[model samples]
Target: MNAILTVLEIVAPVFLVGGVGFAWVKAGFEYRIQFVTRLAMTLAVPCLIFTALMKTEADLATLGTLAVAGSLGYFVIGLAAWVILRLAGLDMRTYLAPFIFGNTGNLGIPLCFFAFGQVGLEAAVVMLAVSAIWSFTIGIWMVAGKGSGGKILKEPMIAATLLGALFLWQGWETPRFLTNTLDLIGQMAIPLMLITLGVAVARLTPGRITTALWLSVVKLAICTAVGWAVGTAFGLTGAIFGVLVLELATPVAVTAYLLAEKYEADSNAVAGYVMVSTLTCVIGLPLILGFLL
Candidate 1:
């Protein structure tokens, strides 16, 4: 009744906006994905993270605890993903990274914000920061078999996280005018990211459909189980705990496919992962939201 309507309110916008991009591509409309992605990641998302952190009412200690638990969730899931890959006799390089990381940025952040309001978003951003740091460093290394950890420092996501933390720690506020400007920019991030997600999926040519399908299921299960375990163990509750499970259980990131293409691993397989995992979210996210609510 009321719960069903509540879930719909939270989930509908994400799908509809993403669906618009999906429909747009199907109708042969132009969407320069690279440019849009660059804008969102470089400018818009950073602003969102900065403002979210700077303005958050959550206790700093709780946020820090959530951050640690989120990292452990990733570590535990990475180990589980590795074991699954080995048992399935899959390629380590092509599959490992995607298994560990999910679309915490594009999908998780918006979903959390919708589900739990400002507090949910505050917790969600912390998880996003943790995911970005790992994906930029070890996740990249997993694909390329080389270290580019330094690149993590240069990422705007990281810069915003650090700066916002500084502001939060010092209990400082930017002038109202600048704060409003940043908030305006931040507002663009979630919708832009949702649309970009759809565009990326529409554009992908996924191979290994069967493999991707089962693997997506595995990914969802492992992340959910591990996230639950970590959150409970850390004594996280309410918005923070819910965000932990949801973010970790998000679909495989589109960036994983891009990284495979760049590193010459197996782009088509990774693309399959991205598409199938995202599709699962159509059902999986709702159920998770139902349970959490």
Candidate 2:
């Protein structure tokens, strides 16, 4: 009973913020998604990642362990997803990336923070950085048939992740005023992302519900298993282990749908996956969190 409340406390705000966005969109209000996304990705999210990395008290060793574990976990999931999609006669280009990558940024980060506090947030950030790098590089190539190495390097999130890691390694801190400013900007990231997620979903017109439902279930099971195995292999315990599992088990990212749309890889199908997978998470995440807690 207590655990249920705890899980609710953690997850309620996440979905509620998203609900607001969904409602806002449904009410026929204007939401300029492109501008908001650009602002968040180019400025707010980078600030969030940079400050979180810079201020995190987690040791370099734990961070590094999670990084390696997350990388391996994603690689394994990608391979499994590719094989599964091929055997099922699904289009790899359209389905594989979404199957492999989860929403570790908007949903994962905040869930970690709420569920396990600061240490969890720190651990979650490492996984998010790892996931973002791969999504920008390999995930892009899967859908577009071409990866932009230059674009990945130019991404603000990527730069922030690298710079933040350097600062952490060097045991350095920014000036107080600067840190405060960055922190303020960074604070906007989570809420903005949650709301944006709702807005995105509300706008999507997903098809193929039956197939998407089964695929989403398969993705959740495979990702949870891989995250647990990799974290155990790496000797991750406590909050770090839990965070890794939870992050990995998050639903298909809305970004995947956007990428499919941009690259002309059956956007409606991708949207179906996103919708179904995310709905699955709404039920699945709390159960997982209950066990973890």
TM-score of each: 0.99, 0.98
Residue-level error in angstroms, candidate 2, position 149: 1.6
Q: Against the true structure, whose TM-score is highest?
A: 1
**Model 2 CA lDDT for position 195:** 93
Query: What is the per-residue lDDT of model 2 for residues 1-293, given as tens digits with 9 covering 90 to 100?
Result: 88899999999999999899999999999999889989988899899888888998888888998898999999999999989999999998899999999999878988998999888877887888899889999999999999966778888988998999999999999999999999999888889989999999999999888889999999999999998899899999999999999999999999999899999998999999999999999999998889889
Best by lDDT: 1
Candidate 2 lowest-lDDT run of ten: 148-157
Q: How does candidate 1 fare on TM-score?
A: 0.99
Q: Clashing residue pairs, candidate 2?
A: none
What range of 10 consecutive residues in model 1 has the weakest lDDT sum?
145-154
